[model samples]
Target chain A: MLFDYVYAVDMAHTAEHGARKAGTRKRADAERNIAAIITAAADSLARDPDASMTDIAKAAGLGRVTLYAHFPSREDLLRSVLAQTIAESTGIIEAVSPDEGQAAEAFARMIRSCWPLLSRFGSLHAAAQRALPAGEVRRRHDQPMAYVERIIARGRAEGAFRTDLPVEWLVTTVYTLLHAAADEAAAGRLATDAAGEILEKTLLAALKPE
Target chain B: MLFDYVYAVDMAHTAEHGARKAGTRKRADAERNIAAIITAAADSLARDPDASMTDIAKAAGLGRVTLYAHFPSREDLLRSVLAQTIAESTGIIEAVSPDEGQAAEAFARMIRSCWPLLSRFGSLHAAAQRALPAGEVRRRHDQPMAYVERIIARGRAEGAFRTDLPVEWLVTTVYTLLHAAADEAAAGRLATDAAGEILEKTLLAALKPE
Candidate 1:
């Protein structure tokens, strides 16, 4: 999946480029600090959604005023972090080769690419799904949903999937299971690799000829 | 599936016969009041696991003394609610027959029976999963897990399901997707029926033979 690939790139850059940018006296330093703050805040919020602003500031090694300057309110900060994460995820969804191999294989690859972000930021995803009005998030959600729907449709056209249920139902099911498996992984009930395997099997089953 | 049927029977009895009994006699009324108190406390605790005893008593329409008489501490009350709910769920699990028809049909029926309770008490479940190792909740989780394991085992033995993944992983995926779908349903992102349909497809995909 392109989303998974984007996340990998983002994670690598954040780790390798973070300290180097901090040492330089330039715009890079400021951007690095902002990224650090967002990452720290995301980690704390994952553990406790209601964690205080001061606590997040402390985790990011910034003063409350500095944190507020970068992002005005708790919601604003959270929204920014989520937007960045979603952008990275969207990039991955766009990058996948929809024409590559069988529909099920391509779909599984997309899920694998996106699993890390979904697993790490699952609570935030849940919050976004709940907090955002349908207008904003719907478009974001539709992008991925469309991708999955296309895959299911292609599978059916190729005679690989049973055409008994609506493609929308299949898309919704795939996303729900992904989000659910990610949540379970976050909660320590299932390992990430195990979740990936489950996703693969699930996609295969959903696509198998009846 | 058997377990879910049993749970429905038990829940129907609790709702119908139990309610009627409480209405008939003073002693039964008192017991019912106590049960109601516990249920209210459980609800509050689900929303806020750290809610105080006084807060629970206030919510339950009981005095602190009476609440303590029924459940001496927060742990006791939480444990009792957990046990009762799991026992009820176990009844439902025991009532299902995964062999009732084709595997997919049986799985769909099972998911329908199981989704509502999971959706309603999901937060409490998340709390219980987190509160393990400090109490008897761990022991209680075993019953449902065992029931699910048996279903998966039976499915695999009958050549109705893929044998690559552990049965436990399949069981956990079923619970996870149901919980996730419930979360979506609760948040109004998806209607209840829609969520149920999505869950059914997801489970069928995950469990059906490849």
Candidate 2:
């Protein structure tokens, strides 16, 4: 519910690029520019969010005008990188079947799948909140969160997860833990593997039935 | 801890204002202006992190020259607000005796004390990270975190909490949950009262011996 308020991006987070023609170098160039721009922007913003479009263009090995043509403003470039990150993370959840397994197993699987993405895009996610309103970020995060909701529901049905707390609250707690772990790993305070292991155990323990 | 890396602003977070001789309204005027500046900056930046010093002076009902005299740059103003808030928060946490009670009870009290401050300052914290290097923020947080570490150590000694996972990992997990819950409440995704209750239960559950 907090997400509904803080991350209210429009529901559609993906770029709708048409399929490329196999023989055209032009299409390849378009694809490369988009990828390079997003990657470069994520890295640049991660370091200094105020990094100019020129800095990003230099990082991406593109001309300033070419970068401008692809992304009209610094906000536009950051937005694209953020959306791409969210879409890719949502794609990770889409690969999992929250309904097909024991609630606990699916929960663990989703955590494993989701944590690294959270770590990889940790700075970008923070950038998204700063550049966009809370509402916009909330909506962009909704897709991946829905999968999380489904897993909690399935876990409840299997009587594996406690139901004392509302499902929404439980969901937020798990996310809080994962994000914290990811932050630790990103800062090198905790090893990535150790963060994951600790999260899996603590998250599962917290969700277990009384 | 991620905090060890990102929130270290030196252990002495308290303001050490110099004592002044009585009968000088000038001393009071100077103190009031600094407080007003920090307060105004926090509110304005929470709304828009890019809010200008002029905007902050307007909010504080002071002139631009005065605001500039107090905080030379936008970054200076934001960093001060962050430090003041951290100092106040660390003061809240320092008043509580973490090792004196059952770890779970102390943990709950700490959350009850911390979540609101985290919610109130969430944007300011984000603004600080963007304005300064992560190392500065990390140092500021280290003072409060040392208290949290003591609680976890006590819990482990009492056999009331898990030890397989390092104490540092557990401490970060709790901070993460508080922050995430604070984010939810700040966004109004969850009610403040409900977030507190849910957090208390979940945190306690997670820390219980498996």
- Best candidate per TM-score, number? 2
- Model 1 chain B weakest lDDT span, ten residues long: B129-138
Q: What are the per-model C-alpha RMSD values against the true structure?
A: 15.9, 15.6
What's the lDDT for residue A194 in model 1? 66
| DockQ of model 1 vs. true complex | 0.20
TM-score of every candidate: 0.61, 0.79
TM-score (chain B only), all candidates: 0.71, 0.78
Error of 1 at A158 (Å): 4.4
Compared with the true structure, what per-residue lDDT tens digits does model 2 show for residues B1-210? 888755454433322222233435677887899999899888876656566778889999999998888788887887788778878888888677666778777877887877776767545665565566544666777778888888888888888888888888877777667666766665667777667678778877888888
lDDT of 1 by residue, B74-112 (tens): 667777788888787777766786446655556777777
TM-score, model 1, chain B versus true chain B: 0.71
Q: What is the DockQ for all candidates, taken in turn?
A: 0.20, 0.32
lDDT of 1: 0.70
User: Model 2 over residues A71-107: C-alpha lDDT tens digits?
Assistant: 8887787778877887888888778776677879988
